[model samples]
Target chain A: MSSRRDILDLLGENARYTTEDLAHMTDFTESEVEEVVAELEDAGVITGYQAVINWDALETDAERVRATVELNVALDRETNYGDIADRIAKFPEVTSLRLVSGDYDFDLTVEGDSMREVSHFISDKVAPIPEITQTVTHYIMESYKEQGTEFDDHDDDDRLSVSP
Target chain B: MTLEPADRVDAVPPSGIRRFFELAEEMDDIISLGVGEPDFSAPWAAREAAITSLERGQTSYTANKGKRELRTRISRFEDAARDLRYDPDEEILVTAGASEGLDLAFRALLNSGDKLAVAQPCYVSYVPGATFAGVDVVDVPTRAEDEFKLTREVLEASGAAEADALVYCYPNNPTGATMTGDELREVAAFCREHDLVVFSDEIYADLTYEHEHISIATLPGMRERTVVFNGFSKAFAMTGFRLGYAMGPEEAITAMNRVHQYTMLSAPTTAQHAAIEALDNCQADVREMTAQYDRRRNYVLSRFEDMGLSCFPASGAFYAFPECPWDDADEFAEAFLQEQKVAVVPGSAFGAGGDGHLRISYATGLDELKTAMNRLESFIS
Candidate 1:
C-alpha cells in the first residue's frame, strides 16, 4: 500500500528494476509489490516502461533526426485544432503532440532518419491536413542533455575507495 | 637531513581506516559500501554557477569572512530551516570545508589544557582535531543500548560533566544516532548545568530520514554558547568544492576569522560562488537526494533484517551499523572482502562502542547495493 508511490518513482527512473528489487527498496513484500503493480497496470497508471537511451551515441546509420513543429491551425464552429491535431498525431513520426497555450497552438515532435526525411514527412503528411494553416519546423542538431541525463558527462566515482 | 613529521605526530596516530584501505586496493571487483561520502555529484546548477564565475574572471580571493551574499544566504537558510538566526555579518565565518570549520572551532574556542568532551564512536577527525588544538579530550562513549545518543546519564558516567565544552554531531556519523527534541533538551540542560560550551557539528543535518533535523543550538540560552558547523559536502553532494561555514557568537567567529585570515586567506572564490547558488536555489535538490538516500537506507535495513542481523534503527546519516553476527567485526570485514568481494568498514575504526559491528554505507547505486547484499548474504550463510 505505501509502496505504490515508491514503486512508481523507482520504476519511472529505471525500468530495469525487478519486483524483488522493488520489494526490497519499498516497504512491501514481493507478493504485495506484485499486487500493487498489477493494480497500477490494470488502471493504466503504469502505462509503459522504456529505456532512456542516448540515441546520439549509437551508430550513425541508426541515428534519428527530430524536430519540433509549431503548428498553426484554422478553427471555426465546425472544426477545431484538436481535430487537426488528432489527424497529424496518427503518423508514427509524430512522437509527442501537445496543444499548448502561447505563441503556438499545437506543438509537436516529429522524428525521422534524416532532416530531409523529416522535411518530406512535413510536406507530404502534415501539410495535407486541410485545417492546419501553417507549419514551422526546426530540426534538432544535437542533444547535450535529455530527460535530466547528461549525454556527455563521464563522471566516474573518482573518490577514495574508503573514507571517514 | 631526514624529513620528520611535526612534533604532534607522536600524539596523533595515522587514521585507523588507513590500514584496511591497503588490502582493498589490491582486490578486483570490489563493491564498496565503505565510502563515507555521497555518491551523487553536486547539483548541475551549482556546477554551472562555478563555471560562470570562472568565465567572468571572478578569480580573486574573497573577503576573509567570505562572500557576504553567501553568508546572507546561509543566514536565511538556517532561519527558514531551523528557526535559528545568527547575525550574518559577525556570526558567520566560511571555511574551506566542514573539516576546516571543526579545526577552526578547536583553535578559536579553547586553549591549551582546556578540556573538550567528545562523543565517541564518532567521526575519525574529531578527537584528533581537538588534540591538534592542544585541548585534552575526555571520550564519552554513548552506548548501543541508547541508540548511541549522548544522554545526560552517559555524560555523568564519563566525567565529561567536568569538561569545559562538549563536541558532538546529531545525525551522528558511523552510528546514525539522533537526539529527539525532548532528548536534546535533557542534554541541553546538562550542558547548562555543566557550564559546557557546545560545538555541534551538524554536517549531516540535511540527510536525516525519520524526522526533520533538530539542532541543539536551538535550545534556549544555547545560541550564544554554541558554535554550529555545517556545509554543502554531504547534503548538496558538494564535497569536492570544499566550502563550509560556522555560525556562533560574534567573538568566536571573529577569532576563527583571525586564524583563517593568516592560514587559509579565504576559501576558493569560485566554490563560494557555487555555494551561493546552492543556498539560493538548491533546496529541492537536497530533498531529492535525501529521498534517494532514504530509499537506499530502507532497502539495506530490510536486507539486514531478513538475514537476522540486528541493526540499531539508524534515523540519520547514510550508514547503518549492524552488529556483527560473527565472532569479530574486523576479521569479518576482511574475510567478507576477500570471499564475497563486498567492502564494508569495520566499526572499530570509529573508536569505542564501534567494535563488534560494521558500518555499511548505503550511498552506492541501488543495483550495486542489491548485488552487494546478495554477495554478503551468501558469504555469511
Candidate 2:
C-alpha cells in the first residue's frame, strides 16, 4: 500500500488524537509515532502541525492579522537552504514559509496582534541577518479561507484499478 | 491530440485590454471608447528626444531600474506634482507601462492565495492582474454618493480591512473621480494602521479638472507603505510609447527591478528618451490637452443632459460616464452602434457597479463628437 493510505487510515480513524494517542490507538509505542512522523515529514507527505484554536474562546481582546512577507536574501556558501530554513523555523509565529517563483526568494505567513508588531518582527528580526538583503511586507485585511488544511486524496491506483 | 501528454497547452486567459481591443476590432469604422489609450500623439519635443537618443545609438539594454536620466526626470515630476520625494537610483524603476509596474509589484509582493483589496468600477487591469499573480482580489465597491472615491468607511466595510495590499487609482479611469490631498492622507494613515501596502496608480494625476492630484505616498508615515505606479500614457499622450515607472521603499523596488530586467529588459529605448522630454518640454502640451478635454467634457455632459439622459460632471480624466437612457447599458451600446453608427462602451465592461452607465470617450475630434451626439439624439428619440 502507498504511504498515503497508511497515513489516511491513521487520521481517518481518529483525527483529533494527539501523537501519543495516535500511537496508542494504532497499537504502536510513542517512539514509533515519532519515527513515523519523521518519515512522513521527510517524504513531504505530512507538512505541518497546526494548533486549531477557537478565537472567540481563546482571547477576547486578541486582534489577529495575517500578513504576507516577501523576503529578498543574499546567502553565502555556508548559508544554504538548511541554515536559512533553520533560522526562520525558530519563529513560532511564522505559520508558513514557501520558496516561490519570481523576484522574491521566500514568502512568509506572519501572524501578529497589530500591524506594528508584524512590521517590527519583519524589519528587526527577519531582515537584519547578513544573509538577508531586503523585505516587502503586506498585511491581510480579510481571508476568504485562511489556508485550510484539506488533504487532496488522489488515488493513483484507483484509476489504474479500472484499466486492465 | 489527447494522447500526447507532452503537448498539453497552458489554459491561461487573454489579457483584459487585449480582449477589449479584439472586441473593438470586430465592428467596422467603430468609433471605440473601449480601450483606455490616449488619442493624442507624443509631443514634438518628446519625439525629438527619442530621435536624438536613436542618433546617439543607445540600442543596448539599460539598467534594470532604468536610466539615471529618466528616473531623475520622474523624481522631479513627482516632486513638482505631488510633493513626494523619491531617490531616483534606489527607489524608482522603469517598466513597460503602468500595467507592467502593477504586474511586477504583485509578483514581487504576493504569494499564492494572498488577498489584495481593490476598489470596484476600477480599471479592468486590476482584477486580471491579481488573478495572474495567483492572488485573490477583494473588491471594495465605492458608492455613487461617495463619487467613487476610496474612503476609510469603504475600506472598513470591505471585510478586507486587513488585505495584504490595496491598489488605489485616482482621477480614475471610466468614472473620472479624484481623491483630494486630505482624503489621501487619511487613506495613508489607514494603510499604516492596517499594515496594508498601498499600490497607488497615479497615472491620471495630470488630468484633474478642478484640483491637483495628490500622491498618497506624500502623507506622513506613508513612504514606507506606498508603492506608486505612474506612466507617460494618459498625461503625456505617450500611450503607444509604453513607458511607466514605480517608486517606493528601496526593498520593494529592488525586487521589482529584477522582474523588470528578466521580463522586459527595459521600456523601449525611444520611449524612455521621449519620456524625459515629456517631463521637461511638454508642460504646455499637457495644459493644452487638458483645456481641450475640459471643453469636450462639458460639451458631452451638456449634450447628454439635453438628450434627457442623466450625467454627473466628471471631475477628471477625458471620458464622460452617462447613465444609459434605456434599461440595459450593454443593449443600448450595441443597438446604438447598429442603428446610429455611434460607438460607446457599456459601463458593464468595467465592473459590477458600472451596469447602468455608458462610457463615451471625447478624445475624438470635436466635429466627430458633434455628429455622434446628433446621431445619438436621433437614435434615442
Candidate 3:
C-alpha cells in the first residue's frame, strides 16, 4: 500500500522511469508495479506525465510562450466562481487552473505558440467572460527552474577521483 | 639521481579498484557498477549553506579541530543517535572526509610495528592506510556464512588479541554487512577483554536498511577505547565537500588533532558550515535517500537470487557482494567488463575473504541497474 505513494513520488520526479524501472526501485514485481500504476491512473491519482524541457536550449525558431493569468470573478448568486472557472479551464491552452485565495479567484497557467497568440487569447476569449471582473496576465520571461528541476546551471559531480 | 619511493609505500599494492575504473574509462559504453560513492548529489540546503558561507567571505581556515558549531552539532547528533556523548571542544576532530579520519587514527595511535587487526573483505583503505602508517595488519577474515559479521572465534583464530587495536567498519564497504547491537556485544566484550582500542568506521551508519546501526563505542566500557569515524560522504552525499569527524576519548582526539594540526590543518571551512546545516536540517533527505538505497539493495539481492549467485542480503550500504561461479574474481570481472561491457569490482580487491565474489554497486539509476543486470544475465549464462 505504501508502495503506491512511493511510486507516485518517484514518477513525479521523472515520469520517464519505465514500469520495469519503477518495479526495481520500489521492490515490487513488474506486474505488481504495472497493476498499481494502472490503478493510480484509473483513480485520478496520476493525472498525467510530462517532459520537463528547457525550451531555451532548443534551436528551433518557433517557441511556445507561457504566462500565468490571474482572474478575479464575482461569485454568481446561482452558481459561484466555479461556473466561470469551468468555462476558462475548457480552453486548450490553459495548462493548469486552481481556485486560490488572496485577491485572485482563479490562478491559471496558459501556453500558446507565441506571445501574440497568448495576448490574443486573453483579449479575445478571457475578456469576454462576463463573470470575471478582473484579469491579469504575467508573461514569463525565462525559466531558470521548472517543476523543481534547475536548468540555468548544471550540478557537476565534484567528488574525488578515488573515494572508497 | 634516482627518485626512489619508500620501501613501505612500494610494498603496498596500488588500489585494485582504480584498475577497473581505468579499464572502464578506456572502454566504450560500459555500464559500471564499480563506483563506491552515492550517485546522488548533496542536498540543496547543504550546498546552499556552503555557497552562502563562501559568499559571506568565510573562507579563512578554521581551528585545527574544525568549527565549534559543527563539532557541537556532530556531538549532539552522535549523542542522540548512538547514545555516545562527546565533548564538542575536545572529543571531536573533523578531517578531510572519513579517509583522513581513518588515516589520522592510524597515524596517531599506532607505533611502527604495532599490529592493527582489520577484518577482511573490508574497505580497501584499511590495509593500505595501516601500511602507510608503518603498522602491521592482522587480517581477520569474516565469512558469508556468518553474514560477514566479525565473530569472536574468527578474531581469536586470526590472532587479533596480539593486535594493539581493531579497525571495524559496519554496513561495511564492499560487503554491505551490518551487525546488530546484540551481535556486536560479543565483539565489544572481546575488545574489552583483550584491551584493544577500536577504530569504528560508521560512515555507512545512515544507510542501514534492516536494523538500526549500533556503535560498539556505545557498549559498556567501550567509549573510552573506541574512536568513531563518521561523515557526510555516504549518508548526505557530501563526498566532494570533504567533511568527516572522529569522536573518542579526549586524549585520543587530542592526539589525532595534534597530527591533524601539523598535517591537514583543518577541514574545509565552507564544508564545515555545510555539515552543520546537514546535521541540523537534512534528516528527511537522508531518510529518503536511504529508502532509495534500500529498494535498490533489495532489487539487486533478488536479481542475484534469480541468477543463482550466492549472495548474503546486505543490511546496509549500497553494494551487493555475490559469489561468482568462477574461482578467480579478478579474471571474471575483467572478462565481464571486456565481453559484456558491464563493470563490477572483484571481491579480491578488498582482501582475502573477498575472493570468488564480485561487489556490485546499486547506486546508479534503476534503469541502468536493470540494463546492467540484463547484460550480467547474458554474460554469466
Candidate 4:
C-alpha cells in the first residue's frame, strides 16, 4: 500500500498538482490516487485547499490587521478553560487559539478588517468572558516567513540547468 | 596566431554523461532523471541571510580560508555530530565547492605518475581530476553483490599496495551505495597498514536515508591522514552558492589553501554569510527536505522491483543504479531518451564494470519522477 501521508505532504506543498501528477509522484495508480484523496476528504484529514496570498503586496481599500492575544484564565473543577476556549474559538474573527504554558493560559491570534476592529474584538467580545481574568494583545508588524515559506524572493534557485 | 590546448587537456576524454544533457537541451517535452541537484530552492532563511548581507554592504573577498565565523560553525557542527574535532583556524579551508576541494586535494598530494586507487561506478570526477594532476589512477571495480562498497580485499586485489593514496565517495554517486562504520573501519585499517593518504568525498553525507553517515576521518588514527570534503550543495540545496570545506591535518589544509588562494581567491562572501545562517538555523528545513528525498527513494525502489528490474536498494543519496534489460547501457540510455523523451545516465559513464546499468536520479519533483517511471516502463516493454 502506498503512504497516505506522502500524498498529504505533496498537497501541503502545492495543492494545484493534478491527481494524475500525484499518481505519478506517489507510485499510486490514478484510480488509487482519487480513492485515497476522497477518503482523506471524508475523514477530515484534508479539510480544504486555499491559496497562500501575500496581502501586503496587493493594493486594496480594505486591509486586515492581525494580532496575538494572551489570556490569563481561571479554571474550576468542571468544564475548566475548555468551555471558554471553545466560546472564543467559535468566533469567526479568531484565526487560531491554543493553550499555552507560563503566565498565560490561552494564546490566540485574531484578525480583523482594521486596528479599531481588533481592539473592539478584545474589549467587547474577549474581555467580557468572566473566566478570563486578564488579556494582553500584541499586533503583528511584519512577517519575514510564515508556514515554512519565505516571503522574500531575493536569491533565486541556482542549480545548474542539468547536472549529475 | 593559433594556440594549442595543453596535452593533458587533450588526453582526458569528454564526459559521457554530458551527451544526454546536451541532447535534452535541444529537445522539448524532455524529462530528465539525469541531474543530481535537488529540485527545491535553497531554504528561505539561507537566501534571506544572503540578501541581508548584501543590504548591509558586506560584499568583498573573505579571508583566504573563509570567514572565521563560518569556519567555527563548521568545526562545531562536525564536532557535535560526528565527534570530529577540526580546529577551524588551522585544519579547515573553505572552498568554492566540493569540486574545488577535490581538485585541490589531488593537486596538493600527487606528483607526476603518483598512483591513486579509486573505486569504480563512482562519481565521474575522481579519475579525470587525478589524471589532470598527473596521477595514475588504479581502478578497483566494486561489484553489485557487495553493494558497491570499497573493501580491503577489493583494494588488495586491485594492487592498492602500489598506490600512493585512495579516494572514496560514500552514499556514492550513481550507485547510491554507502559503507557502514564497521565496514569503513576495516578499510581505514587497510589504509593505515599501507600508509596511504585518504581523500573522502562526502558531498552526499546529509542525503543518507537508512543510517547515519560515518566519515572515515572519524575513525581511530585516520584523521591525520584523511582529508574530508563536504559542501552545501546536496544538503542545503545551495549548489549555486558554491561553498564547501576541507578538514584534515594542518599541513594538508595549508597546502590545499595555497592552491585555493592561487586559483580561487575565496568563496563568495555573501554565500559564506548564508552558510553561517544555515548552520545556526535551518535544521528543521534540512529535516523536511531529507524526508522528501527518503519518500522518493523508497518509491523508486518499489517501482523498480515491480518492473522486474534488478536493483540494489539504495540506503543513501537520491540515485538508483539498476541493471538495464539490454547489454549496452549507453545504447539503452540514448534510445530511451530519444524515443521516450526521458533522460537517464548510462552507468558506464561512471567507470569500469558499470555496463548494463542505468543511473536514475530521484531529485526531481515527485510528479516528474512518476512520469519518468511510466515512460521507462513503456520503453522497456
Per-prediction TM-score of chain B?
Answer: 0.98, 0.92, 0.98, 0.98
What TM-score applies to chain A of candidate 2? Answer: 0.61
**Decreasing TM-score order of the candidates:** 1, 3, 4, 2
Q: Can you tell me the CAPRI class of model 3?
A: acceptable
- Estimate, for each residue in B1-381, the C-alpha lDDT of model 4 and write its tens digit: 458868787888988778877887788877888888877788889999999999999999999999999999999998887787999999999999898999999999789899999988888889989989999999988888888888888889999978889998898988899999999998999999999999999988988877899999989899989999998988898888999999999999999999999899898899999999999997788889888888788778877877888999887888998998898888888898889988888888899767778889888877778888888877787
Residues A27-144 of candidate 2 have per-residue lDDT tens digits of: 3456776787778779977766555443434557778877898887877877876678679978977988988889988898898888888888888889886787878888886543
**Candidate 1 displacement at residue B263 in angstroms:** 1.7
Clashes in model 2: which pairs? A140-B162, A140-B163, A141-B162, A141-B163
lDDT top scorer: 1
Candidate 3 DockQ, CA atoms: 0.35
Ten contiguous residues with the weakest lDDT in model 1 chain B: B1-10
lDDT of 1: 0.89
Q: For each model in turn, which proportion of the native inter-chain contacts is also found?
A: 0.73, 0.00, 0.21, 0.27
Model 3: per-residue Cα lDDT over B124-162, one tens digit each: 899999999999999998988998889999999999999
Query: What's the lDDT for residue B229 in model 2?
Result: 94
Worst 10 residues of 3 chain A by lDDT: A155-164
State each candidate's clash count. 0, 4, 0, 0
lDDT (tens digit, per residue) of candidate 1 on B67-181: 9999999999999998779988999999999889889989888998999999878999988888888999998988888989999899999999889999998898898888789
Candidate with the greatest TM-score versus the true structure:
1
DockQ of 1: 0.75
